[model samples]
Target: MKINDYLSHEELKRLISALLVVLGFISIAAFFGFTVVPGLRYQAYTTGESQVQAVQGETGWLDPTEYPVMAKEVIPPIDPKTVMTPNPALMARGKALFAQNCATCHGPEGLGDGAAGKGLTPHPRNFTANAGWKNGTKLEDIYKTLDEGIKGSSMVSYNYLPKKDRMALAHVVQSLGAFDHGASDPKALANLEKLFASAGEVIPNRIPVSRAVTVLCREYAEAHPQPTATTLR
Candidate 1:
C-alpha cells in the first residue's frame, strides 16, 4: 500500500500543488516577519525622531535676566520756588522724563490715549481735558499726587523721584491743559515748600530676583548635601 497504489497521478499532482501553495504562503510570511518588518523597524528607530524635538529644542542659552536692584542714595534738598512754574529748561527735562516713564501710560501729548493705559481700569488721566482731575489741577495738588500715588489707581508713588523732578513733571502736566488751572492753595504750597527745604529722600537697598534665587539654591544645596560612601562611613 504505497501512496501511488491508492492515489491517481492527477490526485498526486493536486496534492503537490496544495503543498506548494502552503509553502509559498509560509515563505511570504517569513519574508515579512524576519526581513521586511525588521528593516522598517530599524529605519524607524535609527532615523526617525520625535516631533517634540522641533518645538522643545533650544537654539541658544536660556539664561534669565537679573531684575534691577536699586542702590541706596541720598537726594539733596530742592527749592520749591524754582520748580513752581514750568521754565524752558525744566519743561525740557520734564518732557524727557515723561517720555521715559509716563509716556507708556500717558499719551505723548498727554491725551490718556497711550497704548499701555488702554487696559487700565479707569484709564490714565487725560491731561488734555480738564474734566476728571483725580487730585485737582493745581500745582500743589498735582505735586501731592505725584509724591503720594492715588489710592485706587494705577498711579504709584513718584516719591522715588527727586522733589525737583516731580515738581517739573507737575508743571508739564499742568501745561498740557489749555483751560485755566486755578491758583494753588496757600497752605498746601507752604507745606510743600517747607518739606522740600527741610528734608531729602533716601533710596533703600534692593536685591535682584535672579540673585536671590541663586542664593537660595546655594543655601539649599549646602543644607542638604548628597551622601557618598565615605560620608556614610
Candidate 2:
C-alpha cells in the first residue's frame, strides 16, 4: 500500500507486470537448469552403444551351418583282448568321458560319494572297493553293466556309447579297484568278441537344439499363416 501511494496506479500496474515477467523467466530457467540441462549433459557423457540386430538364418532363426547326418555303417571287428587292458590313451579318453557323463553320480574318483547320489535308495557303486558290485569287477562285467545298466538303480544304459568307447570305460572302471578283477569267463569273452564281429551299429540322426527350434518355429508359421488386411475385413 505504501509503495502504491509512492507511485501512481498506472506505474504500480506496470511494476507488477514486470515482476511477473521476471518470475516467469526464473521459473523457465530453473526448469532448464534442474531438468533439461542435466539430461542433455548426462546424454553427452554416456558411452553406451546401440544394440545390434539378432542373428537371422535362412529359416529366420537358425544359423546357416552344415550339420552332419548320422548314417549306418559297419563297425570293423575289434579284438576284445586288445582293449581290455587300460592303455594310457584309453585311460585319458575314459577319464574325460567319465567326467562328462558319469561324474554326477559316480564322483570324480569313482568313490560313489557324488552329490547326485546322496538321496538315492541303493547308493552309487564305489569303484575303489573290491566288493558289492552288482556286476562282478571283471572287464566284461563292467562292459555289460555299462551296456545294460542296473535295473532298479540310478544307473542308466550307456549303450549309446560306441563299442570301443564302452570298452575303454570298462577298462578304466576295472583299474579303479585296488584288488584283482577276477578273470572274464572264456565263453563270455568269446561271445563279446563275436557280438562286435557280427554286428554293425547305426547312430540315430539328430539336429542341434537351435536348429530344432528354428525348424519348429518355421513349421508353426507355415501352418498358421497371419491374416491379411483384406482377410481381416
TM-score of each: 0.62, 0.58
* lDDT of candidate 2 over 1-233, digit per residue (tens): 68967997666666665566556556655554454332221001001122212212211111122232344444566665656566777677666666555565677789988766677768889999987989889878999998888887657666755677778778777777788888789888888888776666664544434354456556655664544445434
Overall lDDT per candidate, in order of appearance: 0.64, 0.61
The C-alpha stretches of model 2 lying farther than 4 A from their native spots are: 1-75, 208-214, 217-221, 224-233
- lDDT (Cα, 0-100) at 14 in candidate 1: 62
Per model, how many backbone clashes are there?
0, 0
Top TM-score hit: 1
Q: List the residue pairs that clash in candidate 1.
A: none
lDDT of 1 by residue, 109-151 (tens): 9998877678777788989888889889999888889878887
Query: How many residue pairs in model 1 have overlapping backbones?
Result: 0
Candidate 1 at residue 223, lDDT? 61
Q: State the weakest 10-residue window (summed lDDT) of model 1.
A: 41-50
